[model samples]
Target: MTDPLAGRVLRGDRRAVARAITRVENGDDSTDLLNGIGKSLGRAFILGLTGPPGTGKSTLVDRIIAQYRGRKMKVGVIAVDPTSPITGGALLGDRVRMAQHTLDSGVFIRSMASRGWSGGLSGAVSEAIQILDAAGMEVVMIETVGIGQSDIEIMKIAHAVMVVTMPGLGDDVQVSKAGLMEIGDIYAVNKSDLPGADAMVVNLLSMVRDMKGRSPPVLKVSALKGEGVDRLFDAVEAIRGRFLSPAGEEMRLRSVRGMIVELAKKKLLSEFEGRAFARSVEVARKVADHKMSYEEAAERLVDG
Candidate 1:
């Protein structure tokens, strides 16, 4: 029998969307669910926002929503917030600034707990984006769980990524240290009302100039004050167009190839563990004891 939930999701039913996301958060990998949403994916433009904690990424997301809504397009948001270790859940305050649209039928919002990912986002976010795209959202925005330099996996999920920064953080030198400069397609220097804002902008521009290829634009926006948001939205639209063009197909293919490798690795690990968990643990202990190399141990597991 066809799953009614899948039908509801494709029709853009909010409750069904919420229910489906809940399954994803709980680590559901049911074949039926994936098959249901498979063909309908990749229609919406995905915008990913990532930066250090306390940079007000959520506020910027709200601003993006308003811009898309102004054009009468349906919008979907996935706010990935840190999960509470004690409760394994999140307060989900990411939507507080967006409370005004709680009743809007054109907007759909879902908050997912990062589930102990200090820098790694919950693996379920990509699936969530696919659901929203299949549901016909014109634009889907993913606000990452506040991340630092080591977490760059968000790039694989979004067609265009916005790295939001602000004044009074460390020097622009921190951008490369944080590994952000290489991944950002667009940059927003939020909290532009604060001191050092212009310096921040110029620093970002100088950094971009040093890069080899396409220099991404960095705009200043006071996300708190809703200043310069229009310029940011326009940049996103322009970048979105570029992502859909033939020139950008290589980038898209690269992203897909990476995702495929990740999935295959996960599948291999699962099968390896099912048959050889005890053996793998023994090899791990040997490696830790400096008696065996990890490369040899990996070969053992794969060859076994």
Candidate 2:
């Protein structure tokens, strides 16, 4: 049953792909489905695009899809957008930017809401990538929301992590806040037509030089005009060639394991609350009345 759906998706059935993604995202009795799908994964190259907002990430993603299409490669994109906490749906503005490729048979795009999951993405992204991989995409791109700091989660999932930036907007401060330089496998300066572009490049290069052997390659591009995109693709290909070894594959698996453990821990802790632990108001009242110190209250709850 899962094999047929997986085969349909690989044969360019968009509905099958969409249904698979929905199942993975909802995670509603889908483990068996995904276990079957996982056998077909591990073939696709997963690329993670992360950076601050207004850095032209969506535009760059569009250009990447175009370049891949030129090579006759199938591409799948998962665009993670901020969600309305109350409604739990995506604003989906990023998807609107990439609408030009909606009719393209080789490209599949899905918009996901962050849904308050922190880490600049919802936890379902790993499953989404697996679904796309099982669908036989040559490349699966994960575009994360531009939330600073949390965006580093991309490093755990992608074969290559592209940190996009642009001129102005206190690039230094942003890099520091996000700690992106440490996590990025490649640095992209988009919107290179803007002023201060040269200076930004210079600063990034200087920083890269200071970091010495650990720093990734930096490339400048103008996604709107489709400039330097080919070089970016080449860089991606090169990174894959150099790093996609057995050891590198093990590292990625370890990361996935860590994320799963962390998520399961959170879920288990939530299940233990109230029945095994005091409610928030009860703890607050205890603290307010000086019946227990905050640390003592927490220790008691955990001990209970």
In order, candidate lDDTs are 0.73, 0.72
Q: Give the distance in Å from residue 232's predicted Cα in candidate 1 to where it truly belongs.
A: 0.7
**Location of the lowest summed lDDT over 10 successive residues in candidate 2:** 84-93
Any idea what lDDT model 2 has?
0.72
Candidate 1 accuracy as TM-score: 0.83
Q: Which candidate's lDDT is highest? A: 1
lDDT of 2 by residue, 272-301 (tens): 664555455677689999998999877766
Model 1 lDDT vs. the true structure?
0.73
10 residues in a row with least lDDT, candidate 1: 83-92
Output the number of the TM-score-best candidate: 1
lDDT of 1 at 159: 81
After superposing candidate 2 on the true structure, give the runs of residues whose Cα lies further than 4 Å from its correct spot: 1-13, 83-103, 118-122, 243-290
